[model samples]
Target chain A: MKPVIEIESISKKFLIPASSQGYQTLRESLTSLDFLRKKREFWALRDISFSMEQGETMGVIGNNGAGKTTLLKILSRITKPTSGKGRINARVASLLEVGTGFHPELTGRENIYLNGVILGLKKREIDRHFDEIVEFAGVKEFLNTPIKHYSTGMWARLAFSVAAHLDPEILLVDEVLSVGDAEFQKKSLVKMNDLSKNGRTVIFVSHNLAAVRQLCSRCMLISQGEITSIGNVNDVITEYTSFRDGDSPGTTDLTLISERKGSGIVRLTRIELRNSDEQVKGTFLMRDDLHIHLWLEAPVKVRNVKIVVDILNSFGETITSMFDSDSGFGLIEVEGSEHISITINDIRFYPGKYNISVSVISQILNHKYESFDEIENAITFDVENQLVNRNLTRRTGLLFLTPDWQIHKD
Target chain B: MAGYEIKPSGWLTFDFRELWHFRELFLFMTWRDIKVKYKQTFLGLAWVVLQPLALMAIFTVIWLKVMKPAELDIPYPLFAYSGLVFWGLFSSGISGAGESMISNANIIKKIYFPRIIIPASAALTALFDFVVTLFLLVLLILYYQIDVSLPRFAGLFSLSIMITMAASFGIGLIVSAATIRYRDFRYVMPFFLQAFFFVSPVVYPLALLSSDSLRIVLSLNPLAGAVTLARAAITGNPANWQAIFPGTLMTVFLLVAGLTLFRRNESSYSDLL
Candidate 1:
């Protein structure tokens, strides 16, 4: 079979303004339209080249901001590259996100046809698959109801349903199969697997490595806008897990982190992750003793102060929240400079990247949770598999658990 | 399903075939806009009729009573309604196209279709509203006992659509594309359309202008040509094709310029959005 997709040195450049009102207003652009001419240039994608054969499901594995989405966007023809070209010997359909063009005011049925057409399916094809989409989404009863009234899960299911039913020569999917409920996610995965089984070319980009492994015959690893490795799925994933030492930052200076907002009763100076021997580290194995160190300076004595640390997965979805008190576990009062190290005994996160976010809150003025300081995605680390048969090929899902299993004959 | 190629950004890459493939999406987007524009309102599609009908009624009374016409053989309401029909098309098309990019930013960022589809469909939705009002214009013509040749009326009607759509699409294309890169174009559109209304012969006659230079200057506005064409078609009045020629020429220029600008900026929409 011929290669369905062939790329040659594709790259994308973006002009980030040095400073402005964020969006280019008419007044500013009228006065200085050329202000971005001498601005800092960012290469979101850099000279990327790859090729894929027909019926091959290629998995794209990369760290956050590794140009995975940029690659997909280039392939999908949403954005043009600064240089280079790609030749595709198949009709391409890309689902960068579910419900990419769904109208909230329209009913579910209308959205299916609308989104289906937007995804490059013909109106007759949508009419042919109309019943199947309704059945798959399990929203047949609410098909006539506007999508805005549907629950988030229902919305997601219907969106996925329309895209899952698409029959294209090649499909470029990005991080969509990983979303939705577990049961629905499994169904979507099975649909994707079927698509490849029918000899359709698929390029899947997902943070959920397990889904990628299940659906992709080959895997590609991209780091810092370049392909570091591409070949067998197992080999690439192993390389990905091993190449994380320098990628995750161990020490994060929080004072300089601008992604924070608060009323300022306290100031967070720094945050650090430490291993069992009190050595600063970013990569940790499952069931390891993880200590979160927080350095803070308080101006006044704060009463009923509670600190919450959120552990988020690679997609920035909160996996777990650890705190001094979830509900009245005794809020502590603090004044002046203080250092607190919260030790998580036998942390059980599965193999993946994770980020830490901290929130300092106090119940000030009649039971209102007033925030003193907060920062998100400030510190990040990688979790390596730490068990027998420790293959990183399958990301296995978050929160590694050792539930006792017993078999009984009925 | 055959093959395709992704090339570097060109000076102009207006793919007509790709736009044709997205025809269903165009229809749906236009229908979607029409459905959503009046969704959850007390009078949904009725507003399509009520708006123009009310405007024509108010303008007819004011024109005859307050600002009396210098020379008019035809009924005032018929004359007023004919101009309102196409004027609605121009105003809605410009505003619709101007805001189409911003309103569909989410879709533009996620999916890949010709970016022109959004503004073009928005213009079509405006045309849909105008079509509804055309029924009223027909009734006004018959009510006023105007003589309209069936053969000539059809050609004029189609010409009026082409000019109005071309003018709106031409200017709207630029407004919509410019709005994406520089949001100032968003504010400029409403002000431009408001000013354009005074220049067009919407509620008044071009003949009333005593100065030949002023009449020619006003006729250069594309809507003036469309309105004049539409009025002549419905009432069987003689049309000055010369006065309408420059505006028609400007319409073609704007459309070409608009398409060039839109196609140049189309690939960067997802990045900027």
Candidate 2:
């Protein structure tokens, strides 16, 4: 029996504009010719080849820009590879993103047919599954109403429902379960689990390690556009976890980091991590006191300032968020520049790499709050395990806590 | 459905079988285009009929009063309205098909369909508007009690509309694909269409041009041939093979060129978009 998917030396090269300045792209389009434009070559996927058999559910885990999506795109024929070729022996359905072709002006019923057809399902099939799709989405009464009126959750649910009902021989899904309400996320995950159990070829690309471990029998880890590991789920995941470059630099010049989104009312200029001694450092031992020094510059007067820091695990799960207001210390004003020292008395995280996402928010009149600057994965640090307590040397949980125990025999 | 191979191919790849399989998608997309066209508008679909009807009325008054030409055998208003229907299909259809690719970038990036269908569906939305306006012509014909044979007019009507759609689809395919690379077409197209409208035999009949050279030059436009055929059907006049031949040839050329260019560039669309 032939494998459901086979490829030989598939590689994808992208020619990005040399100065890919978004501003120049639009302005130069009117003046310059296509051939005259300078472009820099970058390989998104490098000599990557893999085959999957029927009923084999493979999870593709990768960091951002790791070519996982590019691999899937090539398989799904959304984008042609720069070189090499591949063959699939069965019909393939790819959900690169849910609500792909949904138009806000279109009603839920209309969008279902539209999204269904875009996903390669036939009209009659959609008709046959119409009731099921509507029921699964649970927006039947509002089916005729334009989807613009639907809440974000409703939109995601309806989009997911249409995609979930698509029955194809091979499925290539990319983090579709990462959205929507928790219940809907579970429903789609269960549906995917059933798809694989029913012997359909599935390639799931996601950052959620737990879900990947649950739904995928085998796993592939990609780093810098190459497959670093592919085999047993736990082995691949362990290899992936080990590849994390945990020790980030002690300071980041926030002004130079252009990959940020906000109104820019008050811009963050620099961020530094220091130990209790105030010496600049990023790595820390468990239970060590840490100080996050944030330097801000406000060209204009900013009122009621707020600084928020979100601690995320290696799997992109938010462990907790710290806000200045939590200590009853916000509602400050800044004119030109201000240095903020957020002192954490005890860092109660277990040994692992954790990401620190920073956000600068402003409180306006009428109790309206808007984040002016927010950067996900702005800084990352390693938490080294220090066996302060001999009994808890082998930590099993993500948090380090000292709980008083009352010994009793029942 | 047979699975497809994913490899880079050169210039021409026509997958009629794939297109046949995606026929439902084409219909649905066309339906979506037609459905959402007038949403949130005060008049809704009434705008579709009103556009051509109003244009026909104004053109009728202008041609009759300003030109003050010698009387023709066909009624001026019917001549002008039918001509508008023919022109409308070519103009709006091409425009729709031309903008289809760039406008539907969301679906194009996420999924694969016959790239031709994007333009085809956009043109179909315009054709839907054409059909809505065609009803006005039928009314004019009934109101005038014009001696129109059903079968003969039907054949000519379908043939003319087919030619017009081909021309629009062909041009749309070229323009839409080109617009992806060079945005100049987005601005250049409106001027081209306005100029094309005057050049075609829409508001004025071919007979108005006394010189054969001018008449033949106008026939080079596919819409002129469509207008000639549609006029022949509406008035029960003998088909003008002399005027229709050149435009038909251009339509075939445009269709071939459009398909070839669109296919060649389609593979990289997701990236470019």
Per-residue lDDT for B1-273 in model 2, tens only? 857787765665677887898899999899999889888999998898888889989988898789996666578888888888888888898788878888998888888777778888898898889988988899999988899999999999999999999999999989988888767688889999999999988888888888988888889999999889988987888999888999999999999998888888988888888
lDDT of 2 by residue, A1-410 (tens): 79999987889998876665422333465557545877778788988888889999999996656788889999998899888888999988999999998999999999999999889888888999999999988999999999999999999989998998888899999988788788987998999999999999999999787799899999998876889889999888766654234434667777766445577778888888899898888689888998888888889898888888887776556788987878888847888988988888888887777767788887654857786787656667778877565433224677888889898998
User: Which candidate ranks first by DockQ, i.e. highest?
Assistant: 1
Q: What docking class should model 2 receive? A: medium
CA lDDT, every prediction? 0.83, 0.85
- The DockQ for candidate 1, computed on C-alphas, is 0.68
Cα lDDT of model 1 by residue, A76-165, tens digit: 888889888989998889999999888888999989988888888889989999999899889989989999999989999999988987
Off by over 4 Å in 2: A19-34, A243-273, A280-283, A292-310, A321-343, A356-380, A384-397, A401-410, B210-212
The DockQ-derived docking category for candidate 1 is medium
TM-score of each: 0.85, 0.87
Q: Please list the residue runs of candidate 1 whose C-alpha ends up more than 4 Å from where it truly belongs after superposition.
A: A20-22, A243-271, A275-289, A294-341, A345-410
